[model samples]
Target chain A: MNTHAPVFESVAKEDVAWLGTDPIPATAYYDPAYFELEREAVFRRGWIQMGHVCELPEPGSFIRRELEVLKASILILRSQDEEIRAFHNVCTHRGTQLVEEAAGKQSRFTCPYHSWTFGDDGSLLSAPDFEQFNVAKEDCGLSKVHVEVVAGLIFVHLGTPESGMRESMGPLADRMDELPIARATTISEYVYEIDANWKLTYDNFQENYHLRFIHPSTAGQGCGGDNPFGYPEEYGFQGPHRTQTIWTNPETGIPSAVQGVSYMKIGEALAKRDLMIPGAEKNYFALFPSFFLFGNPGTHFSHVVYPISANKSRGVIRLYWVGDDENASERYAREYGMAMTRDIHVEDRSVIERGQRGLESGALKHIHLQTNEALLRHFFNEVDGRVQAYKAELEAQGAL
Target chain B: MSVLPEGYEALEPFVATYAVDNAGRRAEMRGEAPSEVRDAFYAAAQPLLAPALDYLDTKQFADYDSGDKQLMWMMLSLAHVAIAVEIQQEDEERHAHLRSFMPVTRAPADF
Candidate 1:
């Protein structure tokens, strides 16, 4: 469904004065119109993370992803030539979804409905009764989508392919190289469905202030208490992406109550063995719009936020380990890690669901933002500015 | 085969079978954990086997290898016991001085 075309209007210099501090309309969370506008202005226009490169380890490996909101299907495949490629997951003959499964290794994708086949490189391989149609083989090939990799993480943008992925990722890509993400192996995956605005889920992750209250069991044991850990002043922001490095007083021995259980044991083990990595402390980075990368000194973890609906979001949290080993000890640890993550996710889901119900109460006109929530405020402000600009541009062209 | 723990009757056969399979696999892989320590972990976790088995039945645990879920849970339980034993061992090495400095209190119930 074509909802609305994004419009960009030039803003007066004076109008930009309240850019970051202005309160956005709450309707942005609940409005169907706004969601449609976002489909074009945000999802179509920006680089959205798809999957990791490791997922396509061998040639002919492919994964199918559904962009339900955009009404689009994507097929990410590793070609026979050993290059990763993404194509519209549709058959040219009758517009049928080519790949039905989530992931597998296949040299060619044959549509179940029409028996049309496509090669690993997304070339139209064959069609039954070719004399009937005037379609060329090249023209009948699956439509291509812009795909690029940053440190083994793959991203695809569906809009105009003019803006390169590197250009869109900007400085964030360089900053990500500081961590050894390429060497990391997936240890566990915790998936959860939360009832809340997608932005609210991001709001919860961007700030650690709610850790003590929302995640009392884990976060309180790990971070909260007498000497609360705070975000570093040297916080870096590139485009909509932001990161905050954490520092703990060495004398304290333990940083926060949240750090008491897991971190205390991990830190003690590292310190005693002199195995600590240099220049590493707790670091959290939020890739604008939807992803979070959190490093716990050694273990690297990521959360991919998928917006399913106005009031529902799916969070896929995956923890990565340092080495690639299928040993019993490592496997055992991975299972426990997954269980712990599942418990933590259940905690977050309950809170976000309650928050959504509260938001519907309309008891408060605006949510307060603390210094710790500056990133959340910044994100909303950025979205608001884009939406306003698009609205104004449409009005000016008499297209609204 | 004296009296088994409360839930051990339902789990003992599975645990015994798993122990044999695990030991065989560990031997094949050149793996070993202290026998005394391993026995202690198995004793403590034998009662919780019922719940762990139930959890496994639901696919609650991460699939690390193609094996029975009970065996996987036992391996994980053993790892936790191993880590705890290692920490206690380290404390002993430090002249038991570390324990006196930071007395172990019961962690918060929620935690």
Candidate 2:
């Protein structure tokens, strides 16, 4: 392959003419007030991805998720009517906590608190001494949360969203729907509690610029060869969300050992269908706030960050595959992908923690993003814009 | 699955057992929805509430006493109710949103 022409031009700030060249303030990452504002403005109002629909493949299947930052314990399940629903995992009676298990299959949730049993549809099925209740059974049903499925991914809105999930996702809705996410089953989930601002963790995933420097041995070798990892093949916005398409260097050849144990070939052969992203080995889609969808050769996964507080955050990297792992090569390939992803993340943890400590030390006032980090700039712009709008709304109501 | 530390498995179920994840700082409850009001709401739904309380009280659970067990349980319980209230509040808001979109010429369909 002739390496004469650049496959893609690196993204520059000037390319995004509306986003100025100003550096993002350090306070955006470390300040408590800003964190609170983000909680109220961005997280509460945004259409956030919760999990994949494949997680509960059958009716009566349920899973519990705790969003500590949003202060929510969500019970997501498929009801008897074969509809997916989400509800608060609290027993309405006596305000006792309900559904102790994290994930299970059950038609009814009996609040161990007072034995208030509710159907998978969130309807109150039975309660002790029911006739004496002041609140009617209809009113006593589990409180429902806003949940919608796009591209086989489940998204929940914490507050009354200004628009529907599809509208909120904007142009990415089509791309999301095209993804093989619904057909993929979760294979592994890794959780890391990093001592860094949630945004700091977020900033790490939006670009491949760090692959060469931060992941020289693992990702750098796998993605590129002698030449530096080039900029993404595409960089643009789908509403507030951003997408980056990456191609493996044509000249980059895997080692003989890699070829021998390669799982990609196996996965491709066994998969019923592949993701629709054309000519790209990988695609990075960053949804507003903290959800990131990464499409790989024969698999896909999501990196979701939930801020626990200003300085602490939780990171979940869930891996999914379309075909059976029954094939040895598929298993090997999936394992290879997991090992590589984990290594890259492990490298990131140290750097991001250091970033937070440095920002907190007050040594630097603003952090400069490079030309390739156009997505970071876009993210900060959206966050700042939303924060400003939230402030204005509060001021109008005289609540600020 | 890898076996956890001696009491780690036992304590895993208790993690965020309460609805610690909140939508916003006052959550589903609007301004000044008094604690007494919430208590009264609970009192009226005792049939649904008592079993959950009994489970928490009587269940043979691991002792994280050496590792802040009491504090963990308290947060989980409070978080549970905190989030529950948010759910109740948000459902009403969702119904209202749907109503605004559809024509109200006819009676609502029974669930």
Candidate 3:
């Protein structure tokens, strides 16, 4: 039997025209003022995916995350009752940072400046000369922040949340629960710090229009047949979040000998665990603000962009695996998958940095977007809507 | 004593350059290596990837001694080199600089 069918048809411009064809303001990508508004309006109150539940496995396990965007440090851990929680990594004694180590297992944290001890549940266990201070021990617990785990991904909110991340995600939350990440027991990570705006850096990945040019050699297999650029077959939006069904050319015939073996090894590993369900990798999730999760079962990964400032951001890409490497081939497959993906990501940096430099020069008032770049357009629209609403709220209060 | 297993003696020359156990150091070696060095290793090991994996599959991981560990580490290094030679090709010189920003902080093999 012979079958010839088109894998994808171009998503028409008119289908997404309601998002508007007007050029998006370039200033939003690099402007200091707009960045300030986003910090307050969007990031401050919204849920940011910064860590995974696997990082905090036991009661004493804790990891310190530096939230530069909020100028705050967070200590996420599992308490004695086996509950996961997040707290301001600040000691209530005198505002000194409590935990300094990046990650470790510790039940008691004693402030080095003064040996004020705190328990794993953020309770003030002891302070020297207790009667001398007017504060009660109950009032001295470390400041608490909202932390929730959905699909084994840890998200934290710095300010008051009108709705939690899982609630906000709605149906996408149930969909995410079925993916590989929900069952991940371990992870491999690669991190990059780039001198580009967070949106510009994230937008680089949201669209595949530049794949053939920017990643000519590494991305050859993904681009061919009807979709020369390997564009997504379909795009679905839910509130501020979105998902895309990635398309792949089944017969590009470019997998190197070692690369082919590595993928086959990974495929077998997934198949043994019954993770190779057909269309299991149907689509990937891009949570609001700056987070992305690929749907590929063999290489289940999430990329999050952390904003350090207007023109500087750090991106951490983590590949979640269900268990440890069982044998030589499994280990080799993980290495090849990681190294190949890293090379593809490396190709995107210089071009995105160049894009940021061009935008900063203040030459272009706005930037153009084609039909295929609808995801970027949607992200910009959602972000600007929030920022503009926050500005209006401030003006109403006479605080702007 | 040989640096690799009995059947994989041909890969002994790469033991010193690619047998580093840490993922960070292995990736650094790939970046710092010159074109001739990377190309020669790729040409040498390209044919052995399948056989090497097949050979290692014959033994349990815990039973491996020093020679087997070295060969295993070398094959891991081949993963990085294969991408450089077969994919990046002539663009490696510029690609190396781009990789400096991204570092492998954690992997399953690291533990």
Candidate 4:
């Protein structure tokens, strides 16, 4: 580690050296065997970010999400009691897939294949022939999945979670609760399927070293003068989770004409709600094992990477807005904000796919990481730590 | 009935082309328009951005007459085109292909 205590507006190399400066094994990113281990170790016990609570506003509102990593389809809903819950999207009888529509309002789900129906609360409600099957009605209810809502975001645990996300997140959850997402009644969203590992896609957003080269247009004025690479001014760790204090651009004058007006309108809307102030609110959160919220009230966006296979993953990006547009100016501002963010994202796609192809070739056994990509290193370590421990458990049981 | 508001008669030609009902459809139009069309529209619409918004700001959404509504929609479409003209430029063509994968599924503007 270079022992430089950063001068003025720079991050110190030694500050994150304890995470190690060694070349990480390239196989973890491409090997199918390693991906399988991660499904159980990392994805199973973690409180995965599914969607926001705003999606299910009231009783009977529901959404169906397919989690490919676990080979499960989840149905999340707000029941009559006004409690949010998740359950198997499969019917109890013959396991037919229920809820063909992605989202809607309904208090009951009727299986098209067998006519078995379930209540909003996941209890068995009806059947066509009354008693041909030898199972109790209570036993035929949909399987309940572990779900919890905190800070207006919903999370689900496939396995027994040691702790809730809010408790585990500590102060990060509280800070997020204060962001616009917590109060959001609506959203702007887009989704993409990528030819890369989940970690590879997730890592693309965690570090800033690639910002200057890959996102020149978006990063040009944003990267402060002293910091050309646009690296975060500070790095933080909270258990397996991480945070980065994004470098604030001290204004090199307003952007191009229409773009400038868009930014001004967005700032005014945010200021009206008293959320445009400067503080640690600029910090971006990387909630493991696969969610990042680049939250600042003005341009807050969250991205979630869901693993599809060893060589593929899907990303869902969203901008959570506090309320519906009150006028044309606000509408214009939100649309511009989304289009600009999407422009930056599309530019990074080809580069990320190229990186995945190089790793999949089986040529490199190890990949190097500099001090700037510390968050990437920290993520790999945390993921592998669980994989190795899970391997050890299997070995002790003579299953390996 | 006029396609556009009285003062904005200069933009009448673009009214039929860009006056779409929803935000996502407007976003698609940004990518599908011909290069010459993009050039002409960008040249015509760039200077009027602030004034159009200023006009729309005077009326609450519920009270918008047909001309006011059409102008508002056109201005929203311009949000996408301005980036293509100013920032992305020639790169916008290739970028549009990658953008198709991430469709704008939901937006507050859609409502």
Candidate 5:
């Protein structure tokens, strides 16, 4: 193993205290070294959202997903016996990517590079020169990752088995269950390749303070009227996850004045229908590292931020709709939901890209954060803690 | 009343077909709703169809590749329109009682 020791350091006195109430140092968004540290300390150890169970509902159904920079491709499969399984997408033979397609159902996976085949259970089914190699077929099965399903949503952890999925998720699974997630169906999925750090995108999603300005049409109209909603200080942290639950009045259906313009309109509408869960209503849950899930009674939308580089990120938003009718009405509902999401996402993307450019100027080292954006502060604190912990582990192991 | 516009007939069947196909997929993900209701929905959307065959034929997905970014944007936009129309139509029907009371009177009683 090429152990070029990872350089880990405490944020300077200025950087450390700023995280409490100010935006993180901009350099953290563009520095290559920071990205590497994040991969090891954060992404590798974090519980990442994979896909919904609906995506692989059947016994043989499977979906291929990747965490870009980690070079980790996962094959989420439902075996013949109906057990959900997740395996590293790499073939055991020559270490080639087994499934090249994004998603499909299959009984077996064949590696194009070496023609090695693996069964749905990830057992090594066939390999050339099997007898010549002393390795047993059972022992040659594809590597497996820890997988967990919480409220029809699938999550994977790259960490050790001892870490445990339930332990990793902590209170998130319990909190998520309070919502009507089981009723949700996939409405639409949008992916964007943004020229900004993954953290920058997370920073944008962490607070609703920007809604009045950036999303004036929607947020301003919906909550900014006489009500003028605000984030509660009752925000709490569950393991690496941070959550803030907000309660909107039942009478006011989403404010039409800000209907099309606000980013929260779709979420607000869904919440009113009782399709989304109460915890997800008007509240935000920032699942540490890379995933954020927004819950409401009618719909649940999640955004997964995959870091491509220090300055580039791939953001995926999946909208889940809850309804029995899959007809014109439902289709129309889904389309409208998607459009609203697109408009808001476009606005966010524009701002983040500009933020990235601003960071490059080096004119400013840090940005300020409002009290309502307490989640962002928690995120930075978690990141800092993880980095420190990883360094400590390396030092104890004599690896640093 | 607006002559249903040009290509509306051809678009109708395409829209209906696409809606039916998508409804099937959605039904599979969610549980089955009333088949008749789903069928009727597709039937309604059939008249508003506009297939992307022509646009897709000319543009190479690989050439414009931004890792499914463009395709996602288009799909999201389409989904938004789909849902918004449903909400709007439902709202209109729920408030139809209010509109029903508007009486039609002669422009001038004296003739």
Candidate 6:
């Protein structure tokens, strides 16, 4: 058996020590109380990626996202000024959600409950019985969420973060900015509402260890054999964020039967061009908590894991194509790439639910981590560190 | 009572043919329907779409007028036909159906 050692040299200095020895406690996956702690410690305070700027290509366009775990209904929109912003979807008057549709475009939004209106910039424009209210209209504008757009991706912080997304991402920004993400357009989206914890759903994407076992037919065939996958070419951490690069096996050739697909040609063309991360065909960059971007040469795909409860989560995978100019070749390529990625996603879904069931059973006390699973260890360490610090702070205040 | 545009009495039976199953799954074509079938359906049903869309745009759908509802049903049925054609095209062009399955059958075993 060939076993490759998982390297932690790229992990943050504080997180490096927990690599091999830490057997992740089962409670981290299935415990309801711990899940609540995670919401407070992690999801609430950090910068969460909402969507990409390209999604709102035209000024005045908007998209609404319902984040059930954070108890947040958010509207991320581009104003008439062409700046993207995020705001609570709730009306300030009676707290009725201002936007009803998942997405639409308008320079102004009027709450359906009352006639309260707000501009795309979130400034209150008007409300019913304005003189009857003592509060200043200026003060009652839709509440703003801290929003920043970096490398074409829009991120919102629900609570105050110590630093902005650009600063927090550090060197990772240069790597992500180099991609044509700003010019890339979204082609499609895949949404999965699963019966598993958000972290469990995310952990499945963080490693390539299960490719041979779990994806034996779909991804395994694409990789070229039973053991076609390999260790991440390069991996590292920037604050709470991290990334890993996986090189495509150059020897693998597409079966002629599948060659008509434009997606099949994308990999071969990308391998010849040095557009992606150095020495890798695909790179997985993760913003700690639940956002991940998997970038290949001609395309990039993202996954947002949103916790619905301790045991339920919603995963959205959005695919983007960098070159918008579409001819016959480009159209075929996009379809092929989307179909291939989708099948692999279906394979992973089965195990993620089953793994959660195993953790809930309480028969297993600790889940073992293999040598190549170093990133999983690094992830747990960061999560544990944050949750513990939050616990400590609450204890100090006598609030826990 | 059902409201009918004067002289458009044939609309009810056509709309009744399009009701979705209780499971909300699209009603399937009984046998393999060709693209020409979809093209013909879309061509014939194209005129009905405008009034239904107009009702949707003007928010008259909320009123649930029987005639408008019948038009909506016809529009939805045409969409199902187009979707089934697209699904077939995806299967033939990419062999997507073949790659996504494991060979198993519920059909009666040959004697």
DockQ of each: 0.06, 0.01, 0.82, 0.78, 0.06, 0.03
lDDT of candidate 2 at residue A82, scale 0 to 100: 92
State TM-scores per candidate. Answer: 0.73, 0.74, 0.97, 0.96, 0.71, 0.74
**Which of candidates 1 and 5 reaches a greater TM-score?**
1
> Model 1: clashing residue pairs?
A221-A257, A221-A258, A222-A257, A222-A258, A222-A259, A223-A258, A223-A259, A224-A258
Q: Lowest-scoring 10 consecutive residues by lDDT in candidate 1 chain A?
A: A5-14
Report how closely model 5 matches the true complex, as a DockQ value. Answer: 0.06
Q: Candidate order by DockQ, highest to lowest?
A: 3, 4, 1, 5, 6, 2
* Predicted candidate 6 versus true structure: per-residue lDDT over B1-111, tens digit per residue: 445443344454444454332111222331124546545554555455444444444543346465655554454454444333333333332332322321111100000
Residue A41 displacement (Å), model 3: 0.7
Residue pairs in collision within model 4: none
List lDDT for all candidates, in order: 0.59, 0.64, 0.88, 0.86, 0.60, 0.66
Q: Which candidate is the best by lDDT?
A: 3
Which whole-number lDDT from 0 to 100 does residue A76 have in model 3?
Answer: 93
Model 1 CA deviation exceeding 4 Å by range? A1-19, A185-187, A222-234, A247-281, B1-43, B46-72, B77-111
* A1-400: candidate 5 lDDT, tens digit per residue: 7754323231234432434654667677687877888888887877778888877868889999988877899999999999999999999987899998888989899999878999988899898888988778989899998898876778887876446655666777776766656555444566777888888878888876766566554333334223354334356678777776653533345533223322343444454555544345665677767787776543357788888888898887776656432222233344444445544555567677888888877877876666666677778778878877887888899987
| Native contacts matched by each model | 0.06, 0.00, 0.85, 0.79, 0.08, 0.00
RMSD of 2: 18.9
Which candidate should be chosen as best, given TM-score against the real structure? 3
- TM-score, prediction 3: 0.97
Tens-digit per-residue lDDT, B1-111, candidate 2:
312223333333333322222212112232224455543432332232222323333323343232333322322233223222422233333322322221111100000
How much TM-score does chain B earn in each model?
0.30, 0.23, 0.94, 0.93, 0.24, 0.47
For model 1, how does the per-residue alpha-carbon lDDT over A46-106 read when each residue is reduced to its tens digit?
7777787767879988989877557788999999999999999988888988888998998
